[model samples]
Target: MPTEHVLPATGPAKVRTRPVRIGVQIAPQHASYETIRETAAALEDLGVDVLFNWDHFFPLSGAPDGLHFESWTMLAALAEQTARVELGALVNCNSYRNANLQADMARTIDHISAKGGTGRFIFGTGSGWFERDYDEYGYEFGTVGSRLDALAVDMPVIEDRWTHLNPAPTRKIPVLIGGGGEKKTLRIVAQHADIWHSFSDAATLERKLGILAEHARTVGRDVAEIEVSTEIGSRSVAEVEEHHALGATLFTIGITGPDYDVSHVADWLAWRDERNAQGPLAW
Candidate 1:
């Protein structure tokens, strides 16, 4: 892999833009806050394009009960600590906070990351899953369909709140909606997201992208305008290339609790640089 090329903000003149981005999801579980802060900074310095933490009250892997941290508050602090890399919860739980409050918190963090310019905060959201988070946090754990229905209702409210905020957001804060449910999740993505993220294999991604495109037509949105994102860990670089061909430019690797190791990141970073060097159409 080559070291000369870096992620371009846009493709060469006249070509449509498709920047290969790498996002690291640092799970906020089974780790000390001090350690997590240090790791966040290190990942930015190591050239990660984005930093992400899942929205959960407990560990998602390893021992069931373990050291964990809250998503939003930690994001607020991360906003101040990292200067270049974009930051956000991988997918914040929509059921945990009022839609208006969620909007306000994102705006505030967006401001925190912005040093008098467009902020680097990605407003990644989803209808809540992980029933344990809801049960323990006192939120009602509704069925997936109902949760998705609530998300559809809350999205417009969140956008409205953004408009009413005193400072507003530095930029339109790219909203990333995660999940691939055709009935509702993709529909919400069509109506609200600037980014649509999912964790699907090639065949599934192909089918879902088609469904997402149909959703876009219903909402009168052009499917191409929405950036595609997906998560990959324990997968080969060949798989990454396959997903890129399927419209996923943003690839996320999730790290679990306790040992937030990034030893595997170097190869992916090299792959990104090499692939980007071949020109935007190489993927």
Candidate 2:
């Protein structure tokens, strides 16, 4: 089983105040839709807190032309399929769709998942990265700055559209921004995100948190209001503990498809339960 890898402690532990939650990103490539849907159902049954899919037109790894499903449509299907798990893209590319349209789609899915009460949809998004997705789809393949700039402009439009919609979202849709770019990305996260997801290691996360806090302060928003989320792929328990100590409450594992093996998931879930059982602290 792949376990969380231990890394050198960068500094003193920070108190974790939020409940620990486990998330899994089901990479929607190189597998049939039936298999993917089954995997989603299975993971929810295993008690995962969040389910995510990546936004891309093609396989990120393996055969470039392998079988793949689109993120938003698949997410809608998953919303109807699963009852309890919150689901979204790990990071939906903002460049692909119009801002109002994206917001409407998210709102629709939110309603679909609500069933009766609050929605289980989280809108996790980021500035575009993959060039091919843009090239083939004919979106302007602008530079990183341009894409991030576009994202900054579109976020408010999305939020405003949500407010104007006839039936506003069942609940305030949680916005999860995925990136670590200090200048533009983190600033946008401070302004908009309910959750900030990053792939930073312990030391990097600590440093970036400082930057994010500064951005939040400049924006007159409390940094503590944003949840800290980290990708904890194959890292050992001790490493995960170190990240937890640094205040990352949501830990995610990404699994790719074909045959999505989940034998190791129980280990992570056990760790999650253990952390929850113990309550948040600097261990």
- Which candidate ranks first by TM-score, i.e. highest? 2
User: What are the RMSDs of all candidates, in order?
Assistant: 4.8, 4.7
Q: Give the TM-score of candidate 1.
A: 0.93
Q: Which lDDT tens digits does candidate 2 get at residues 112-222?
A: 999898999999999989999999989998999999999999999999999999899998999999999999999999999999998998889889988998899899987
| lDDT digits (tens) for residues 81-111 of candidate 1 | 9899999888999999999999999999999
lDDT of each: 0.85, 0.89
Q: What is residue 29's positional error in candidate 2, in angstroms? A: 0.3
TM-score of each: 0.93, 0.94
What would you estimate as the lDDT of candidate 2?
0.89
The CA lDDT at 242 in model 1 is 79
